[model samples]
Target: MSFAGFEDDIGGWGPPVELPTGSGDIVRDAMRKEQVIKEILAAQDDLRALLSRVNAVQGDVDKLASGNATLQTYIDNLTMQMAKRR
Candidate 1:
């Protein structure tokens, strides 16, 4: 059977590989190779998605850090004013 439809599920890295019939050894080898290629492509896609999520989390951390600094400054200013009134 042709593996043309299988490539779409694995990120569509390339065209599908056609395996020959009638030879057990040759067909087994081809199927093994195809499975390895699909695994590699799937791993690559997973890594790309993980990197994108990491970048988004980093941006959120930066925004939180900036807001914390602003709040600290405001608190310090208020504390100074209160001390002066005491």
Candidate 2:
């Protein structure tokens, strides 16, 4: 006997009805949505920049590791030659 705004017996309103215009709420909502979109775009750009930095750092790490390996191999070969001569 008291299901005035509800759709079914779940006792919950289905959805909020749109109010009459000229109340400035529509403008406010639009501005809020725009701000949120701008913030999201800015966040996305920041993430992209961070990822690029990480990739660059990874490349540097790889290069250092490769250089270290190469240097170690050369040193080992030189040491073996000196031992054979002596």
Candidate 3:
């Protein structure tokens, strides 16, 4: 008998795991381990995606900062010109 494609056998397609017969404790432990592994993999994938998004936003912030510096320089120059006109 197999649950979630994990056959309770000696030689199988997936990794050979010996499960206890009629021992609900062992079976429950295996199921919990499988669930934890799946969750960990999902979290890893999510973290990678979040990191990529953060890097992209950081690049945009750098561009915005560069533009802000250029605008500030232009404003300073305009202020000097207005003072000379007075």
Candidate 4:
């Protein structure tokens, strides 16, 4: 009825068993995984901010293109008037 020679011990089980040596390594690995996840999330936020800025720049560029088109039309009209005067 005895297992490994400690059956009579108060707990009816043997003395505390030593955990496998790799137990601490398991905890460290979990911590590393969590840190990696946090870094990935921060990078995602940065990418989102960068995307927002890019979108804003695209809007400004579109406005500038429209303004340039208007200026070109105005310049062409003025050239025609000058030629007529000459």
Candidate 5:
């Protein structure tokens, strides 16, 4: 026998059985929760990317500071030589 164009199997393993109407709401709630989890994961990925960029900028700043300190030492040595010649 067939109902709604689906043949019923004697072993009760035919097409999927329909859920109760009230269960539909539960399924929707579960799907919504899954969507929220996905959004939270995406936000975490964005934060990680931002942190990586900040770290890169900090490394660049450190290099510039080191270069500046080296230049200042060279200038100080030149000033001392000029003063000795005076």
Candidate 6:
């Protein structure tokens, strides 16, 4: 899950190239980058929370399925007993 070694392989890269632009333009670009990063991180957190909830729901569904199988077995046994008595 870590990209730690990739940095060494791609290291020694020159600084990012920048075209001449007004100071206001540079400030706005930096602000936009910060906002985008924040939104992306927040979205990741939301997805993690959603995954946890989905796992819990799956557990509940499994329990219900097990209970239904037990009930069906009981019903089958009862039906066979009544038939034998008659």
C-alpha lDDT values of all predictions: 0.88, 0.88, 0.90, 0.88, 0.89, 0.87
lDDT of 1 by residue, 1-86 (tens): 34865643553566775656546788787988899999999999999999999999999999999999999999999999999999
- Runs in model 6 deviating more than 4 A are 1-24
Candidate that would win on TM-score: 4
Best of the two (4, 5) by lDDT:
5
Pairs of residues at least 3 apart in sequence or in different chains that clash in candidate 5: none
What does the lDDT come to for candidate 1? 0.88
lDDT of 2 by residue, 1-86 (tens): 65678556462465665667644698887888899999999999999999999999999999999999999999999999999999
Residue range 1-86, candidate 5, lDDT tens digits:
46796655644666676766645588897988899999999999999999999999999999999999999999999999999999
User: After best superposition, candidate 5 residue 39: deviation in angstroms?
Assistant: 0.9
Task: Name the regions of candidate 2 deviating beyond 4 angstroms.
Answer: 1-24
RMSD of 2: 7.0
After best superposition, candidate 4 residue 35: deviation in angstroms? 0.5
Please tell me which predicted candidate would have the highest lDDT against the true structure.
3
Select the stronger candidate by TM-score from 2 and 5.
5
List the candidate 1 regions with Cα displacement exceeding 4 Å: 1-24
lDDT of 2: 0.88
| Model 4 C-alpha lDDT versus the unseen true structure | 0.88
In order of appearance, the predictions have TM-scores of 0.67, 0.65, 0.64, 0.69, 0.67, 0.68
- Report RMSD (Å) for each prediction in the order shown: 11.5, 7.0, 11.5, 15.7, 12.7, 8.2
* Candidate 6: tens digits of C-alpha lDDT, residues 1-86: 34754653443476665767646688898988899999999999999999999999999999999999999999999999999999
- Writing each residue's lDDT as its tens digit, candidate 3 over 9-78 gives 6465768677666456887979988999999999999999999999999999999999999999999999
